[model samples]
Target: MTRPIAGWLSDMDGVLVHENQALPGAAEFIRALRDHGRPFLILTNNSIYTPRDLRARLSATGLDVPEDAIWTSALATAQFLTDQEPGGSAYVIGEAGLTTALDEAGYTLTAAEPDFVVLGETRTYSFEAITQAIRLIQGGARFIATNPDVTGPSADGDLPATGAVAAMITAATRREPYFVGKPNPMMIRSALNRIDAHSETTVMVGDRMDTDVVSGIEAGLRTFLVLTGSTRREDIARFPFRPSEIVDSIADLVDRVGTPA
Candidate 1:
């Protein structure tokens, strides 16, 4: 018999909404969680927006996720740094999301002999900023990135993200950054810790096999893959690991929330 799911963690994009629209059944799934008084969180690898900003964006798309219920790569990165080195200084290369999280975590943003060269997602990644990051890493600052997603989707096409820029810095400084986002497992662990939920009774629903499913499995959480995003059913065979359950989308799991799989 499967253990009853007591908590939930889901990916924001692909699983719940895509672009500006909520995926079919996504909103209902969220409502079911609320109705049952279940603990849940919406996780995203994007580090360009704060939770409040993310909540507003989701609301605009008709998904009413609470501000505190959304977690981002920026927050995970900041929390990781705080655990590794409290009150540390960093040379940051990102926008308000990353900077604000670091600031609230009591990390000083600087350029001179900083403790780490923190990289994250940004709408406009400047060449000058990358150059400075290279120099900073070369100057003995450790490299840390919010996530390892190399490219992000845009209306025009795919755009380079933090991972791509982190690769550049690694090539120039010969130092690879420690990514603190999905697929790292540490991010999922941190989220679980924040919710005070045990892995045995929590389910992680995501649209990607590489990041979401892998991280959840490694963290000892039951993993569910939804085909509403980057992954397809056929793609599952390509991965060495598999999710505990597979659903068409969030809609299919609404009725199963209160029951064990």
Candidate 2:
């Protein structure tokens, strides 16, 4: 028998859960991974919630993911900053997730001659905060954003995300922010490092082609696309790239667990 894949990575939304609802078979897929002792992480571009908070949110959706099994853009950004300049300071424009990650990485949060004006996802964006970020970036602070998602789905409708705000700041300062999330491939690489997973033996499952599939391919992992979220099967032909496998939902993947792609 062929050996099972050594590691797995999945996007949090669409692949596993939609909003507060668990996608069908998400729990089963996670259970299968756990049963086979596969090292895995649920990746997310959202940078507002801590891993513990995300664990609780997932649990509410009927999925039992451990805190250590969650990786967010906030964590990736923090790791990147630590590697670039250990113990540096930043003027942050995010919530607890970003702040906590930066703190744990030994970065002091400050607005006084900060190294970077770090931006992330948040429910509310104050004009004062944006103004400060603009001034900081224009004053020689490097601009860095957690993700480039322009819009996010909300209960009411679509809402402006980090990318939109980043654009505003860019327009004012004429300095573009370095996006550290998916589509850049750095996020995927950092996640693999977090789990000590080899790209050759790791499989990435995500619902979006632009962010998830492209990033996974760039990172040299086997990519699987599901039709439970952002991208539909019809949209597949539009993209220049493609996923290694396509399934209707996470349910179909449950039986394929422990089987090498």
User: By TM-score, who's the top model here?
Assistant: 1
Top model number, lDDT? 2
TM-score of each: 0.98, 0.97
Candidate 1 weakest lDDT stretch, 10 residues: 252-261
Tens-digit per-residue lDDT, 115-201, candidate 2: 999999999999999999999998999999999999988899999999999999999999999999998899999999999999888
Candidate 1, overall lDDT? 0.93
Model 1 TM-score, all chains together: 0.98
**Least accurate stretch of 10 residues (summed lDDT) in model 2?**
1-10
lDDT of 1 by residue, 9-127 (tens): 99999999998899999889888888888889899999999999999999998888898898899999999999999999999999889999999999999998999999999988889
> What is the overall TM-score of model 2 with all chains considered together?
0.97
Q: How many residue pairs in model 1 have overlapping backbones?
A: 0
